[model samples]
Target chain A: MPRWVRHRYASLVVLAVVIALLPLLFPSSYYYRVAALVWVSALAAIGLNILMGKAGQVSLGHAGFFGIGAYAVAIGPTHLGVPPLASLLIGAVLSAALAYLVGRPILRLKGHYLAIATLGLGVLVALVITTEIRWTGGPDGMPVKKLVVFGWRASGADTWYWITAGMLLIGTWLALNLDDTPTGRAFRALHDSEIAARVAGVHVDRFKLQAFVIAAVYASLAGSALALMNGFVNPDQAGFLHSVEMVTMVVLGGLGSVIGSIVGAAVLIMLPQALTVFQEYEHLLLGFLIIVSMIFMRDGIVPMLAKLPGRRA
Target chain B: MSKQSHFKTLFAAAAIALPASMMSFAGTASAQQTVKIGSVLSVTGPASFLGEPEDKTLRMYVDKINAAGGVAGKKLELVIYDDGGDANKARTFATRLVEDDKVVAMVGGSTTGTTMAMIPVFEEAQVPFISLAGAIEVVDPVRKYVFKTPHTDKMACEKIFENLKQRKFTKIAMISGTDGFGASMRAQCVKVAPTYDVQIVAEETYGPRDSDMTAQLTKIKAVPGIQAVVNPGFGQGPAIVTRNYAQLGMSSTPLYQSHGVASKSFIELAGPAAEGVRLPAAALLVGDKLPDNDPQKKVVLDYKKTFEATANQPVSTFGGHAYDGLNILVEAMQRANGADPKKVRDEIEKTKGFVGTGGIVNMSPTDHLGLDLSAFRMLEVKGGDWALLPPGT
Candidate 1:
């Protein structure tokens, strides 16, 4: 193997080892619960980075797919009698198919128009989930069945921590691998200039659609994992606010970096928990921190850090 | 390149400075010396209207109790988290309270979805959770560690149906929001209407944020044999429904609201349309108007006085739930004689005839809420405020 290839994967290997050793640091199940939430959100953020950072496509309504993924697990077990694990797979497939259908036409739009189109898609999904009270449980939400493998039912924050962390590692690995492939180059080409990419025979339309679908699947899997972990699912999981939150996580984490995704998820999730100590001033302080970070770190935390005096390539 | 390095240096300084700032705010609690009680409320966001008062009530009551010598001779420590009405955040805070804070009990959940989300957490940890939200499903299956203070939607339905029977209004029209609270109340009302010999002539539903329900109300008004209109929901939907009902000049058709809108804000929002409106509410709303012989009078008055003085706001029914929850937990602690979670769980289940701002609660192994239909007082908006209707009138 080439030394360049080996060096390129060194950080991913370090991340895997770090995740494997994190259980020893957990003070209680509470830490594990929060760790799982961070991992689940990171998984979604990493996939989103591929679309937003690599392909330069912005989706303000990806929570629509996330909500679909959650409802798949929630409704599948109770209504279809499918096991939780199978339902997760069902959710991923459905999300991918929906993304393909939705992305084909909507992906043709550029810049803010694409964002608005995705936003509409998300709002429509939330409305359907809210109005279909009989099956979706309306706004109050429905209980999700625990994921059981053989006879062992999945419970506890520790169990979810390991499961979500493993899934996140796999998701990051795939995204990193995609970044080095021909399709990844095609995505970058289109991102820089779509007309130039089309003239260069890069299949601009197909690669953009591929990125959208892949991101949708990643969000779906994360959503399914979250619903199973919490034992609940609601329409808000697919609402516009959640979509905005996912986008914020990707941008805040340094756009295209897998490690940045993890850092972004950790900062946002833990910042709120840490701010609880502030009591009445929690929201005010949180808003201040977000604004300050965005103003200073224009390219995101990781990308900016990589440009350090001693670290520049 | 210099700017990039400058940001790197700045962020490095920020990374070091951030933890130091957090450390200044952090203080270790003496966990063994105090009986720690944790609570999760939607103190901000859309549900802040419900959570703000609940948070104030708990703080006021906890201070009052500790000032009076504390529960079981141990100083009480209250740890509260704002969930912002999100279930995922509620679950996280509930776990943090149980595992990190090591709270022996919990006492607040301002929304039914949030309370239900935390049920498995409390049940798994074996900590007694006294929920302030009103959802029968929270305690219907009877988890050993979960209890609630507010009356259930089923109870509210029965109260409304019984009132309809008293008025000889056999035919009725219903309009509800499509939200969780509205959906649950609509289900319960439909389930109980037949038992009271009342037929629902027209059934219509509106979205949660719909500013006008005239289209739906107009459809109901067109239905023949409709004697009354019932709107079961919280927030602006019911208020809008009231305005639309009056605007259509259906003044002869009595309008009924569910207990979800039992608040001064509802009256204010609905304007003059709220006059002559009827609903079932906790006795706390009409505390001053209650007869001297009423059992809940003293408890309601005391809660209203202390909570108003501390919170600097008028008492709300949502706040009354928090007051009842804390008081019930304190009473259970006195009976159990310790802060052990298992003992508190057992003692809370044995609670009976405890007069609260909501009503007199009677608990059994099967009933966690410990309140029956009697907990709801039939209230009418006589002028601009809630007025208790005379019994059997």
Candidate 2:
């Protein structure tokens, strides 16, 4: 194994120890709820980073797939009589299919055009969810059936915290391992220069499409977890703001680092909770924090921390 | 002093001050014996107009209750969070309020969607939640721990249909926004129209973001025997519709707005176009016009005075919903003789003949809202202000 892979394995061990010890510090179940939220968001952010940092593509509307995943859990059981666990798989499959269909054409576009295409796609999903009042319950949102395994119901903030943490760890491991694969190298080459990558005999379009579909699956799974945990789903989950939030999580954490994506999710999710202490100035202070962080730590929280004394890549 | 010395001095001060403050706070909390009540409102987002006053009303009433020697001899501690009209934030805060803050009851959620999102949390936790949102579904198929103060969309439609029946307007036309609020009310209106012998001759829907409703209004105008035009929606959409109605020379056909537009801001937004437009609203909007025999008159007048003075703004029905919700919860807690969640929930359900700014609330095991179609009054915009239209007019 390479030296960097050895280092990553060490870091993963540390991460697992930290995750195991976090419950000891929780003052109440509310902390567990916050922890669960971080894990769910981290899962989505890692998926986004795969496309953005690795393949060098942007999706301003991952919330579209996220919403699809959420509604699948909500609508599948009541409408289609599918179990909640089965519906989660159904949501992921549906999101992957949608991504495959749309990614073929939209992935050809670069930068802002790709972003706009995804944004439009996300908006269209939100509109359908909002207007199809019969199926999706419109803007008032709909209740999601709880996840039940056999006779035992899946509940409690602690249960969700562990579940999401496990998923996030798996997602991060996959992303990290992908870094050494031929497809992963192709993605980086395309990200740096599509023409140069094409000359090197890499299947640029096929790799981009694969990255998009994988990211969509990641977002979809995260959305299913969120819906199942919250016991409800709304159109806002698919709206532009949520899409923007997902993008911000990937960028703010460090576009290229798996661990950075997780940290980014933690910071964004926990910052608002912490700012509650500021009361009426919460929004103002939150805006200031984002602005200052971007200015001082331009490469993101992970990259900046890695640059500290005696740190290794 | 040098920068390093100054930083050390500040840190030293904080270290000393924090423990001293903490000791005092713990002592006060132990001695006073307070009851914590949580609220989540959209205090700074699109629904701020609703949540801002609701927050003020909760603070004002909690202070008043404490000043009046507390409820059941325990001081009230209010824990409020601004969800900013976001469902995820509302759910997060709702859970925090229940688990971390250990609030006995909750009393706010400015919008229908936000309130709906928090319902399951309150249910699972077995905490009493008296919502201020104006959606029927918040109470219908009622969750055991959930109740609301605002009149529902179905009640609003029934009240309007009753007035139309009295006015002998058998045929009406409706143009509603395609948003959730509009869609819900439009469905309710259509469902209840036949009961009042009111036929909706023309029905059209406009997109939520549409600036112009001229096309929809034109279609409504061409429909023969359309006596009245009703726009059941919230936000600038209804104001735009009213302006377009006037522009199309359809002012001769009476225009009706749903309770969704029951605020002075709506009149201000519509300007002259809102003149003579009718709506079904809580008595608080026209308290002075209510007869002395009316039970709601005193409650409405008192809330208007106290809220306007405290909030430094005119009173609105949305604020009245918060006032009613908080007061009802307090009364229930007092009746239960303690802050035990299950006992308070039972007492709230048993609430009867409770006079509030919104209406005379009579809660039961089945009816969580406690108000009916009669809670609303037929109010018309006379000049630039609300004027109560007499019964049978």
Candidate 3:
């Protein structure tokens, strides 16, 4: 455990400092806003990493939890008069509880069954958001009351960058801490060999459910953060493509490592902005990149980059 | 004395550098003597049909202005990008145009989803946006920076419902797209159902690419008094709905389709089943039979010739909406004299009597959308062409 901590400690500190100073480099508030989006997406991907990467579970419909988080912020404030901060917490708790109930029976299904069930769960949430027009603003999405902190509303890009950065830092720390714990070992063992882990006294079912619910809460909070930051929530945020994008981000980054997931999301999100000239070919290029990267470097970009030495390859 | 002078000198230097540098930079940028305009549209996606025409229209008009020695003594530099039916992408493109591309005014987003996504980008960047999309939500808050040039879904629904009443078809079955467009019309259809004294007895929905909608249409057919079926959106949606309805032997029941399907292609796609399909369209479009003396006729003919020669495809009303949106924004930018974001936005908000391919546009702070309900002409599809309905028939 001490050795594990020592190995990750330097990387964690480096990530924190880089994220802290990112806003200073941005030329405008727009880039800060984009950075905020990255943080929110990272939050969701980290949650899924616990399930897909850690526990070897499949959930193609994680956007459902994400939407629940967003809509909770919208519904809680406007309908129930709950404050935005509380609404975010309440949304997370609600999504976790729901995930616990949903994951119990469905988690038993292996592979494709798990994938399709999760996909259906996401679609069901989207259908509800779209159909319940009187509440969710229909497909147009409703504007959320802006999030406030310390008697001040975060009005500029710089403030939001700091706020989201703070959240990501705390989230990353908590996630990193989890990796060295006994639960983390059990999860790893279960992933490597489920039957063997069971024989070795791992509570596979309980741990799977727990990881799924915890990830659900994380996704919910991420969704709430996005809605609060943007001051709007739409069906598109919770749509099917968002679910697919989350899974893609999870895989693109080193799945087993939370840091890898972060790198994956940041690259995918910022790649489009960088490759503006061959803009039309973005989807084609990204698809090809995903295929080639997985085929050649199964460990993902981080592991591949780490392979280079002093006179780096 | 040294300390006081140090503070005074630093403050003076800061104040002097700010305006002096800005003035010199501004002098060089605007020194070229041309207005800079921005266009945000999906040149690639499902809605590219609208974006391509919008880009062509803006480029053509900008070229025409430059050839005539520029608008207000400056050539128009058009900056364009694709939204790709993704809101996040639209937001990114909006920022790029306003920040990196340094465009003064922006135009063109055909889908409600993309336009809504770009709203905050324009709001925060303070770039003036003129959209080809007709979603009411785009201008619902009436943001100072956002303006639309096309008729909205609400206006279309009211115009369409009133036209149906004129045709003496009250009991209507409704079919709508399963996406935002479908939901928008479905909501409007239900709300206005009581006003028009029309009962929407049955409503059926199908996803955009669904291989079969026979189940939903069959339910509508069983609803006995459904004298006509109303489809809110055009494109592949109404085309498929009409074909299915025809096979079910409801061809003569006065099927009403939204102005969205104003293209003559819907009739062709529906084939033998589309003989009596009623659609509300902009008067300027499918007015090929109008006399040469009419100004509307001239506009349509000129657009057709230019559009066909360019895109090598028949021009639909959506393309006309794009042409109107860009043409009107350019007119307003011309009125404002240069690319001052605030001046351009304010001038566009107060625009009036601006005529283009779609209809005469008159914008205001309260009404960001320029065209009125009367902009739509009720037409019937007869033998694969749009025919204006008989006067009070």
TM-score of chain B of each: 0.93, 0.91, 0.88
Q: What's the candidate order when arranged by decreasing lDDT?
A: 1, 2, 3
Query: What is the CAPRI rating of model 1's predicted complex?
Result: acceptable
Estimate, for each residue in B1-393, the C-alpha lDDT of model 3 and write its tens digit.
123322322222222123222322221233356567777777777777767777676677677668888766677787676666676667666766766567777877777777876777678878888877867778877888888877777777887788778778788888888667777877777887788888888887877667566788888878887777888865587788888888887776778888777766677778878888877778766667765675567777787788778778777777777777667776776788776888878888888877667777788888888778667777888877778886564
The TM-scores, one per candidate, come to 0.96, 0.94, 0.90
- Among all windows of 10 consecutive residues in model 3 chain A, the one with the lowest summed lDDT is A304-313
The sequence of per-residue lDDT tens digits that candidate 2 reaches over residues B1-393 is: 223322222222222122222322221222238899999999987779889989999999999999999889899999899998899889999998887788899999888889888998899899999999887888889789999999988888898888888889999999998777898888888999999999988899988789998988888888899899888998889999988888999899899998888898889988999998999999999999999999999999999999888778989888898999988999999999999999999999999999998899999889999997789999999899999998898
Across A177-240, the per-residue lDDT of candidate 2 in tens digits comes to 8878898999999999999999999999999999999999999999999999998899889989
lDDT of 1 by residue, A32-57 (tens): 89878988998989888889989989
Off by over 4 Å in 3: A1-7, A310-313, B1-34
Report the Cα lDDT for residue A108, model 1.
91
Please give the lDDT score at residue A60 for candidate 2: 93
> After aligning candidate 1 to the native by TM-score, how far in Å is the CA of B149 from where it should be?
0.5
Candidate 1, chain B, TM-score (2 decimals): 0.93
Residue B196 of model 2 has an lDDT of: 96
State model 2's lDDT.
Answer: 0.86
Candidate 2 Cα outliers beyond 4 Å, as residue runs: A1-5, A310-313, B1-32
Clashing pairs in 1: none
lDDT of 1: 0.87
